[model samples]
Target chain A: EAGVAQSPRYKIIEKRQSVAFWCNPISGHATLYWYQQILGQGPKLLIQFQNNGVVDDSQLPKDRFSAERLKGVDSTLKIQPAKLEDSAVYLCASSPGTSGEQFFGPGTRLTVL
Target chain B: DQQVKQNSPSLSVQEGRISILNCDYTNSMFDYFLWYKKYPAEGPTFLISISSIKDKNEDGRFTVFLNKSAKHLSLHIVPSQPGDSAVYFCASRYPGTYKYIFGTGTRLKVLA
Candidate 1:
C-alpha cells in the first residue's frame, strides 16, 4: 500500500514571506496530523484532523500558522510571514483510526532566510 | 513540561552486541508505547510497540520492556548490525487517542 504523500520535498523562503505545504494521506485513512520537527528534535504536533473536522490544534501558533483538511483526504499547512525560527521540516502523517501507528510522509524541509 | 524524555543522546556498540535505549514518560495515562527508527533525510518508521498491560514485547531482534511502576520503557536490539545505526524515538499515547508524546530520540551507532 502507498504511504502518506507530501509535496515540495524542500522549500526555501525569506523571512516574513508566506509558504504552504500540502499533504495527501493514504487511502481510507481517517486521521491526519501535521508536525514540525526542528533539527535535532522530535516532531512537535501542530494540528490534527479527523476527517474534515479538526480534533486538536492547541499547540498551533494561531498568529501565523493555519491548516485545513478538505474532504478528509488531503490537507495543507500554511505559515504566513514566516520567521527564521520556522526553519524546520513539516511532516504529515495518517492513521487508519483514532488509535494506531501513524504512517509518515517524506516531509517538506522549509528553510527561511 | 516535557512529557517524554530520552536521556541518552547517543550510543555506540560493536556489531553482534546488545544495544539498549531507554525512555521515561511522566504521564501515567499513556497506555500504548511505541519506538520509531529514523535515518537521515527520511521520515521515521515504526519499529515496535507494546501495550501498557504487557511488561515485555519482542519481535525478531527487537524487544521493548515497560515498567509501569517506574514509568520507564526501553528498546533492546540484539546482535546489532551496522545497518541498525540511526536515531530512535520513543512515543506513547493514552487509550483511545492517536496523539503521541515523543522523546527527543537517541542515536545508536553499531560499529562493525
Candidate 2:
C-alpha cells in the first residue's frame, strides 16, 4: 500500500514570508498529525486531527502557525511571517487511530533566509 | 524541558556484535514507549515498542526493555548488521493522550 504523501520536498523562503505545506495521508487512515523537526532533534508534534476535527494542537504557535484537515483525507500547514528559526522539516504522519502506530511522509524541508 | 532523552549522540559496533541504545524519560505519566529508525533524507520508521506494564518485548533480533521505576528504556540489537546503521529515536506517550514525546535520537553505525 502507498504511504503518506507530501508536496514540495524542499522549500526556501525569506524571513517574514508566508509559506504552506501540503499532506495527503494513507487511504482509510483516520488520524493525521503535523510535526516539526529541527536539525539534530526529534520531530515535535505541532497538531493532530482525527478526521476533520482537531484532537490536539497545544504545541502549535497560534500567532503564526495554523493547520487544517478539511475532509479528513488531506491537510495543510501554514506559517505566516515565517522566521529564520522556523526553518526545519515539516513532517506529516497518519495512523489508524489515536493510539495506533504512525506512518510518516517524506517531509518538506523549509529553509528560511 | 525535554521529557524524553537519549544521552548518547552516537554508537558504533562491529557487525555480528551487539548494539545497545539507551533512553530516559522524566515524565512518570508516560505509559507507552516506542523506537523509530530513520535514514538521511527520510522520515522515521517504527522499529519496536514496549508498554510500561511490560519489562521486555522481543522481535527477532530486536528487543526493548522498559524500567518504570527508573523511567528508563533501552533497545538491543543482537548480531547487528550493517543494515542496522541509522538514527534511532526513543518516543513515549501518556495513556489517553494523543501526543508523544521523543528523544533527540542516537546515530548507530554497525561496522563490517
Candidate 3:
C-alpha cells in the first residue's frame, strides 16, 4: 500500500514571504493531520481534518497559518509573512480513521531566512 | 505548558541487548499513549502504543508499559538491532479528543 506523500522535500523562503506545503494521504484514509517540528522538539499538532472537515486546529496560528482539505484526499498548509521562527519541518500524516495508527510522509523542510 | 517530556536526550545500547526508553507526562486526562520512531529527514512512524485502561501492550519485540499512578510510560525493545537506532517520541491523547501532544524525542543508538 502507498504511504502518505509530500512534495518539495525542502523549501527555502525569506522572512515576510509566503510558503506552502502539500500532502497526499493514503487511499481510503479518513483522517489527515499537519504538524510542525522545530529543532530539538517533538512534533506539535497544527491542525486535523476529518474528511475535509476540520476536527481540531486550536494550536494553529490563525494570524499567519492556514490549511485546507477540500476533497478529503489531499491537503495544503500555508504560512504568510513567514518569520524566522517558522523555519521548521512540516509533516503530514493520515490514519484509517479517528483513533487509528497514523502513517507519515517524508515531510517538507521549510527554511525561513 | 509542556505536558509531556522525555528527560533523556540520548541513549546507547549494544546490539542484541534490551533497550528501554522512558517518558513522563503531567496531565491526568491523557487516556492513550504511543511511541513513534523517526529518522533524519523523515516523519515519525508509529512504533507501539498502550491505552490507559491497559497496563501493558506487547508486539513481537516491542512492548509498552503504562503507569497511571506515576504518570509515566516506557517502551522496551528486546534484543535491539542496529537498524533500530533512531529518535523515539512519546505522544498522548486525551479521551474524546483527536489532538495528541508529543514530547521532545529521545535519540537511541544501538551499536553493533
lDDT of 2 by residue, B1-112 (tens): 9889999999999999999999999989888899999998898999998888899999999999998999999999998999999999999987886578889999999999
lDDT of 2 by residue, A1-113 (tens): 99999988999999999999999999999999999999999999999999999999999999999999998899999999999999999999999884547899989999999
Residue range A32-59, candidate 3, lDDT tens digits: 9999999999999999999999999999
Clashing pairs in 2: none
lDDT of every model, 2 decimals:
0.94, 0.93, 0.94
lDDT of 1: 0.94
Q: After superposition, how far is residue A25 of candidate 1 from its true place, in Å?
A: 0.7
- Write down the TM-score of every candidate: 0.98, 0.98, 0.97
DockQ-derived CAPRI band for the predicted complex in model 3:
high
Q: After superposition, how far is residue B47 of candidate 1 from its true place, in Å?
A: 0.7
Q: TM-score of B chain for each model? A: 0.98, 0.98, 0.98
- Name the candidate, 2 or 3, with the larger DockQ value: 3
Candidate 3 lDDT over B17-112, as tens digits, reads 999999999999999999999998888999988999999999999999999999999999998999999999999997776578999999999999
